[model samples]
Target: MCETNHNHNIKLDKNGNCNTDEHKTWNRRSFLQALGLVGGGSMMLANTPLSVSRPSPLSIALSQSTNENILVLVRLQGGNDGFNTIIPVYDYDVYANARPLIRIPPSEFINLSDDYAMPKPMNKLESVWGEGQMKVVHGVGYENSSLSHFKGSDIYANTNLQEDDRTGFMGRYFGEIYPDYFFNPPPSPPSLQIGSIGNLIFKGPESDYSFAVSDPRRLLQIIENETFYNLDGVDENCTYGEKLRFLREATNTTFDYAEVISAAYERSPEYTDSSYQDDSLGRQFRIISRLIRGGLGTKVYLVTLGGFDTHNNQIQRHQQLLTSFSEAVSTFYKDLAADQSEDWAGRVLTMTMSEFGRRFRENGSLGTDHGTAAPTMFFGPALNGSGFVGEHPDLNNLTRGGNVTNTVDFRQVYATVMKDWLCVDEGLVGRSLLDTDGGPFESLDLGFNCSGTTSNIPSDGESLSHIPTYSDSQTFINIVTPQTTHIDVSLYNIVGQKVATLANEMLMEGVNMVINVKDSANTRLSTGPYVYQIKTNNGDYSKSIIIS
Candidate 1:
């Protein structure tokens, strides 16, 4: 287990002492000197072939090993239909036949040769896939749930279908592993929620760990201004006043750190184009690239691209939105490779998710209604690589509205990421955030035996009854199942709310489906213990992802 250093401080000096006036002066001069040094001609020269290898002097010294574990979550809000983004060229004949209006012809796909290909707009990712660094997770979803944008999104975001899970899965891990020092909280002018008010993936109770900075370059400046310093204004004691004060201070520190990061990005010779649609999603990815290259100490980052609520106009909108996502993500990947930060190279992992997938059958509008069981993708360094995880539900065994049944529990993916990729000990993960033993994994073939050995198979429902022998925070259900899928599973945290609707819409039998959930980035769901429930065709089942 990684030892927690509760005394860690962000103070300027290594001696664990206060900065001297002379030292402060030195830093100020250093900051101004660095600013003055940026010459236009020098920038052009740096951009030339001569400056390719020399990274910015401002880049922070980071341990390549730990840094490589960075997690980049790209939330495709409004239910991104994975079918269109990652078209099955080998099966395109079937997919195109399913939704002629929305299908990307086999001719248009960038083939991987093994029956699958990326949509044309995602040509950039295709190139990355060839490099043996990318992995694709198909047909990911939980059992017994269909496309209901609101509930589906919440499920994925919360991981535990509990309504009272105040802290998110990632947030809980961060809090337990890197407990915040109250003295040095986040500086904030509070960045805008570009796609929305942040996803549940980043929320926690300790220090404010994540910031949805719409434009870090601009927002950083506002946070650092002296007026906002310490954030306390004249009306310091008032509730609103105190709130403003906190935001000011957080904003200041964030920008100060961002300045150093921005400089590194500016120095890099590799430049990612602002091409690809020029939309908010495109811009967000562009900025993420900037921050990463800039050497920001950000470990968990969030970005989203919406418009997948394809209740209508599924063809045009879904296509365009996905193109933007693919293009931007691909470009970001290419730029990272060119930076030659191999340590940082594979360190970044990007995953895509949505509320819930549309129905397996098409609606009369030449579109699809809110159905469950859609495909999701997890392509990044930490993934097992190539191929998929989890099982693809049989489309024939769907619910009333033709929602494909699911086989995988979305929390398994989160558990894998929290324990396997990020290296957080299961104990530190906090059961309050993820109660894996419960929910969809209980019935799936994930291979989890709870017998000490880590297996990928889901456990028997009875096994979920045991309060884990280990810490609730870090224990993960070891399910043994294929990683790829046709219909996907996702998890969400529902605060203390009990299972209100456990009734299955009464569908065809055989295979059971799972739930898909998503949530806000900041703030706790609600203060109380919670339960995660998975509603499937057979019945509704739930366990605790988190018990807080």
Candidate 2:
């Protein structure tokens, strides 16, 4: 017979095996009280059944309606040789010469229209890229970097030069941006990281905001502990009375919240099928997509696809590696696109980065070794087109022996996303996020030069009549700065089609200079992503923003 325990929250007949509680004891009062409260590894109170259909207090407090804003970071484990991944097909002669046997024939690539394209396996991305929703940042890395896989990944993950603290740069961003969310569980699910194991990026002081969930179906098994909650034997050892009470309260509090999260996930759709690798990492991404689709309230999700440590048989292995990596990512993006969740299209941003790129030349063993400077790809929603951000160094001009000299630092990318993409303020983000051979990079300027000085300088009084503003329901984007007197701002669609003319005239050197835009009427344009470019008479500035 199945044993039942009421107050203890645990049940065992005689053999001392755990019996499922089904969260019967998770109560409403305890559940609501724990809502919106940050989490910690401490004892909690006994639980009672919560209101079935009511939203958790935490979810209500966040008021975070589905904005569709999601960040998915896919790590291509093992060293992905950049040279072959995005081979210079136009310059195939040089590439073929470098990679004699391994070079993928030009015909094999998914021809990305203008002479460049991803490998055949990455054809999935080619479709998205052609659609203008995916972006590829080429030749991104650091200078004088350690080639060790662990050290390199540390650099990518932490974005710190010395790699001292080991906290994820994203973790710090999440911690600072939503301290309460990081400290407390979101009303739906874990905020920062959702996987079988929590990453360093999700770790915070007193922060149990991360949950290492392997199976959403199994989460309830951990949440409802029948033996611990029952009033009868909770004090079986009968130690300190005060300690026992503290433990009970803490346990109850945590389990009550956990129960709510488990219930939400239980209703989420499962995406994985036999075609997926059936690996732990594969399963994790599938779950992540489900949670995101289910509106789990996760902001940044991280999952690593390992086995990139290609030392031997690097040819066959690396080929398969890239194939699997691209396939998984391509499918993931498609899944997000198919998701009917309100936030899926507008808010979700999926990106990938490695510790560093592989060496420029193949090693003696026909395999490329650890090197620096690789490309990072940002896929999904408002992300702009594909192109190399930093210049790829000449093959002959190596950094040390033959390492590709890094033109753009990795942290610059992080800072750009943090400051511009995510609206995080680097100045107040605390501590230098990336270690420069010099110091922290200038706050990640998204290449949008808004300096206060420019030549055609419109005086303060000049009515920049074209300046856009939210006069009514129309969305107007105005470019103003302290550096330039006049700047040009234009809107472009994914097809490289210039949609609306937001600003093509002069502007003053002050704040709130609104520019009236033509063709910006809500009805004229369909809901989707658009790129905004600002070309100052002095320099060029561009940023991508989504219009709801």
Candidate 3:
């Protein structure tokens, strides 16, 4: 098991310095940075280049069914301090008592409701709220939330509490919708991910669905130059050489979308919104607005704003982060509203998500520690009205560790958005979220519905279940099939080189088939981690397995 350290649980002295031995551990960001993946341009996952001549049936169907509504997921990279962001004016005494130094004065905050107010740094949202373009879902989080940044992020992205689960909910949805995604990707990039390096949000079973760039500047360079790596000289004879060649080819194919992105950017009007600061978050929103206005057709876009882990000197740091977020978001809508022909502002929905919230009580430092539950803010005219969705977590009822119990499950929020905003089918949304374990999660009404238009994608209703297990000597794959289906199974190395074809035959109905890797491969396999992909008429599923 990986070592877990809670940032808020660290012992600090009166000087606001750690007094205990800090466990120097690797989080997802640092690990990706060490691998030279973070801030090193775009990440190319295992996806085939989209064919220009012929669009797939699934692609055409998605194009026709989708009403051009887009979802922008803004990630507050570190855990945001919910108490500070959404001040509980009704319980101001308890809130002030917890953080007297960092608490926002009543005069400094703008009142949103009789009970709740927002800090002055986020004053820009006040106008948005008055226009009925904003809504707050109070105390949104899961039970037993992981306070560790890496794990918490994974839980949010994958919607799975299991530590070993790697696939994300969006990835699973894309996998189901485009079962033949490896051979035929959609016309445009399915999603565009900017920043938030090493996040699994768009990770499908066999590949990642997003065209992920390190930053807005790198994306602009790709758009301007139509850049791609040349794979002419790569030797493909040896195993390592073959993997390198494959990766390079994949990287080049990823740049294929650059042409469309560039075309869209070139056709769109320049951002003249002076309210948008020339900061990281502002730049991201600016680019996203251009793509949407220019008809890129991408459905989802994820952008990041870091430095939310306000462990010390909370007042100034939190203020700056929230200020950037508020200004960029507010200005983005105005930029979209400028395009009166499209009503682009109504078609776009922006939502904020952080891994978790800060503790109810303040630590020795002027900041709060990692806690549970925070207010999730939804912005855009599509919401129809501005209001709170759920009750705020009670300050009097805190966990033994000084964390508030989440009043609303974050998955419920995801399910609702997927069903309503994106027009995804309710059943498919449940499956995509892996909500089968506890039965389907109930959706919350956030003032909008799908308008009777649903996705054309078909759901794989318990047709197959692919499970992989390992013994001391060999690996075994247990597959359950409800009906006879042609199944193809293959294994690939970590770098995405095809290692072996395990099976290429039909699976009988109502039969539990367990295939031994050693016998199926008919060769000695390397003793390390490998991914096994199961392809069937139902869908494609993949999981990581260790060979001994």
Best by lDDT: 3
Q: Which stretches of candidate 1 lie over 4 Å from their true place?
A: 1-67, 88-101, 113-115, 181-183, 186-195, 206-270, 274-277, 381-385, 430-432, 436-548
Q: lDDT at 41 for candidate 1?
A: 13
What TM-score against the true fold does each predicted structure earn?
A: 0.59, 0.63, 0.71
Residues 425-525, model 3: lDDT tens digits: 77778888888576577778788888867555444466577777877667899998888999999876544557799999999998888989878887666
For model 2, the local distance difference test gives 0.54
Each prediction's whole-model lDDT (CA): 0.48, 0.54, 0.74
Better of 2 and 3 by lDDT: 3
Task: Give the lDDT of residue 203 in candidate 1.
Answer: 54
lDDT of 1: 0.48
RMSD each, Å: 17.9, 17.5, 13.1
Give the runs in model 3 whose Cα sits over 4 Å from its true position: 1-64, 210-252, 271-274, 459-548
Cα shift from native, residue 461, model 2 (Å): 27
**lDDT digits (tens) for residues 94-147 of candidate 1:** 566667776777677687666667777777677567665566555677766635
Error of 3 at 258 (Å): 1.0
